[model samples]
Target: MEGATPPASATATTPDAPSARSAPAGRPAVVVLSSLVARGSVGGRAVVFALERMGFPVWFLPTVLLPWHPGHGRASRHVPPADAFAALAADLARAPWLGEVGAVLTGYFGSAEQVEAAAGLVAAIKAARPDALYLCDPVIGDQKPDGSGGLYLPEATAIAIRDRLMPLADIATPNRFEAGWLSGLPVGSTAEAIAAARALGPGTVLVTSAPAMMHRSVATLLVEATRCLQAEHPLVEGAPNGTGDLLAATFLARRLDGMTSEAALPRALGAVFEMVARSVRAGSDELVLAAEQDTILHPMAQVTVRAIATPKPRAK
Candidate 1:
């Protein structure tokens, strides 16, 4: 973690509401804990901006700080001392305004200790407000071009996320590799992804970069308590990082605004797709978040979402 700040309350009555003063006036604030970058839209930066653009105030906690995403190049990396990080989290847990947190979304972590601290903070928030939602984006790894690379984060950090933070999450967002790694199952097809997601134990799971029915297109798979959904859109090649962070944050925002997973899935996917396409077309190395803020606020891209039917029971 970089700079620690006391969590603050903010007002947001509606999903499309305008920003107001930081207070416990209306909608509860969303707390985002992730990595921060000075020159890129990844981790907390992506999550915070998307949430705020959707009219929700955010309490941002940086798990680490870098000049840019590691993929860009090596830069100054800062992880707050474990003791100080735990202390800050404890302070947040005891804050009088804990009830103001309507939801939380955690992405990349700097260390295994941070994952444990995050679980404690999530528990505290749930205690203060029983209805609060927690979305965990297990930013552990991605499928490389050949789809052979393994976990990007250290094994200890990945294990901590799987063991400590994931079970606490109401919703889990992981890419194909992460889903397979976490569940110890193959996710090569839609059915495999659904089974793996269910086995991952979250009430709901969103698997990005899922296999799609449409050739050359990518899909986002949403496996919830009732049904399975796939939102398919064209895959953008060489797209910038942080789409996962953006999607998780936006989806959580929509859910907080009372949208079901069925409804939220498309909008969140559309926004991410639009942003990625636009950024790629513009040939930017990083996500063109500021230039594409309009997409986040009001996505115009069309994403086809279809409910995947469960097979009928076999004859006895």
Candidate 2:
């Protein structure tokens, strides 16, 4: 809420701009809306690079801009004025290349109004191409050292995402804390996570950092209408931020490439895990996506996947 207005240089480009270029034969372009950090691989920086590296052209719009992730230190922040943001969204909605977008992936928002604008753009893309997918990563909060978690974003912005944008998503990737907050259910275990995913309203829900069956490990749960799959791997301590952004982009890219959710889950999880491990091993605070590009294309990290029983509904 307290940020400088984006500079004029950040204004929307015309339809003929390079960002509006079409995708290759099989890979349709993806539109990514998130934050941009000048020096980190978080938000749009991570999402755009990963999608493009996977052969999908990306149209990236920043919801906010910062020198680096706030976790680093105090820095200048820039958020586009609500009207200007809406105008840019309107421009994209009417662009002739709108039909080329196969998916729209949304994450952080600087304001509630930005959510409305982004929701409108997603609706426009869906209208232009009915098959287009929308994946929403509710980038609100994470678990704290005390084992409690809450939103890092403004309550109004989070409410906007939950009420307006989420219902429009075909798939949602939320961390355990976000899953619980969105569904108003406890997500302290795998069973509770499955229930919360089912209640989250998306056809597909991937809960990252889910409780694992094995000690000192973590799981990513993929919940659908009838079946749920769990992908577990060793947790990498001190893994930097942006893993979720990478996961969401990778999963969406895989889905667009015709990979089934069952198949994409493990691949995406493996890529994220490997990226984190490599970054931590390098003793870097940010993901080494560029140096570790091989991990994204061909992840060798092993992850175990299995079907999980969906919890039965409670009756009065």
Candidate 3:
């Protein structure tokens, strides 16, 4: 929150496709994993939406199919690993996908098998496209005030990420709680947050909804090998969900397409903040993020990217 911007709101329904002027050159295509039968939950939709708007062609692998709209209510039964992985592998095997992949971003894995499938696919992608970056938004639950547990992925998922995948991942987007859980550290303060990121880091770690004392609302901070940003947004009571998902997607697309975390972090944070602020002012339960869609390419909100804490090595 050291350098934050004022929020913005729009007056009309904005189109999903952003203006051609700001549209950027296409990057290597990205693949996102989501719930197949989602009612379009906030998290999943945000990933798909942010990637496409940023000028990156996007593909999806649904780990589960919701019986109804995802945000509508409870999730329908999940798609077990065997079924989900077979489908995902087939997509990656297509001849047209041979050499153009730039990155693979995964979110909302629902089962242990699904996590395993995702890990194998991530490895395969790297094997085939050695240059492609891997960005994982481990969609496990972060600490919430209501004590809601994050969606359960088998312990295998965490092990795979920290031990197997993070080494390969160019970036990771974890909320405050997930960061602490994954790193086995206390993330109760900005200092702790910075340490956790570096200690558990594969490379740059984008900690979303990571709590901070400077502001009441949840915060998203970015920590890289050398650059880190502490972005603060005012709390909006009863705001829409999936902000972390949206932020993660935005950051990944920019990073893969060649923006540094310094540039991409502010873009992601500013975009989500303005989008949420607009939704709050409109008195709408759903987010009015159409205005911020362009932030996928050009971030409107400005902030300074700084390193607040020194990186510390973790105990083995």
Candidate 4:
């Protein structure tokens, strides 16, 4: 809690007199808990950048730290001890500014214990501000090169996320593999994906890398109680990691800015698609977020959106 408190003078905001240096007024802060890569735009790095670029203040807590994404090469990983992580979570839970947090996004966890602490933090934030939204990105694994999928993290860690964090989430942004694994349903087809999404238990679920109706295209399906919407764009080969993290942050920021899920899906997908395309075109190993930041603010990428028919209940 050493740097938790701000000076009294810093607390005052001049709403009547705006200045170039003044912070954006009335924007609720978002708390992001995930992995941090020192030299990559993955995990908390991607999430924080997207939210901050959208003018939302962020309180980022890294679950693990690495020099870069593990996909690139071997790297040292650091996870805080359980006791210390829990203590830090406790501090944030009891913080005076907890009420200012409008949303919480949880991604990769270094350990099952960290997931437990994050669950507690999410509960506290909800209690402090009932309207706060929680988006859980189940970063367990993705489809492997062989077209098969499994958990990259320990099974215990994956289980902890499925059982502990997912239950508290208002929204879940899981890839096709994760959605299938978490819901214990096959997601090989659009219908199957929709069924799995409904089974996941969140009020809203976004299934990324969904089965696209059009060949050579990628789709993200936004599923809710009564409706399902799909936003699709042509696939970009060899795109870097962190699209999921970026998508979760972008969609959440749009929602907090008063956009409906229907409105947010296309915009968020467009931004992520544009970011990836731009980065790939530049032949960069990582997403060129700093160089092409304008895409995050006003993405001009074309995305096709359509409403999918919700599956009817099976008669007994």
| TM-scores vs. true structure, each candidate | 0.90, 0.91, 0.79, 0.91
The backbone clash count of each candidate, in order, is 1, 0, 6, 0
Where is the poorest 10-residue window by lDDT in model 4? 1-10
How does model 3 score by TM-score? 0.79
How much lDDT does each candidate structure score? Answer: 0.84, 0.88, 0.65, 0.88
Encode model 1's per-residue lDDT on 1-316: one tens digit a residue.
Answer: 1122213321223432222212366667998899989888989999998889889989888999899888887778999999888878877766656657889899999999898888878876775676889899999988775857888889999999998887888999999899999999998888988888888878999999888999889889999766898899987899998999999988998998899888889889999999999999999988899998999979999998988986533467
Q: What is the lDDT of residue 14 in candidate 3?
A: 39
Model 2, C-alpha of 39: deviation from truth (Å): 0.3
- Give me the runs in candidate 4 sitting further than 4 Å from their true place: 1-25, 312-316
Error of 3 at 213 (Å): 4.5
RMSD after CA superposition, every candidate? 6.5, 5.6, 11.0, 6.5
Candidate 3 local lDDT, residue 243: 76
225-290: candidate 4 lDDT, tens digit per residue: 889998899999989999999999999999999999999998999999999999999999999999
Identify the runs in model 3 with alpha carbons over 4 angstroms from their true place.
1-26, 36-38, 67-72, 80-84, 90-96, 146-164, 289-299, 302-306, 311-316
* C-alpha lDDT of candidate 2 relative to the true structure: 0.88
- Look at candidate 1 and give me any clashing residue pairs: 1-80
Candidate 3 residue 79 Cα shift, in angstroms, is: 1.6
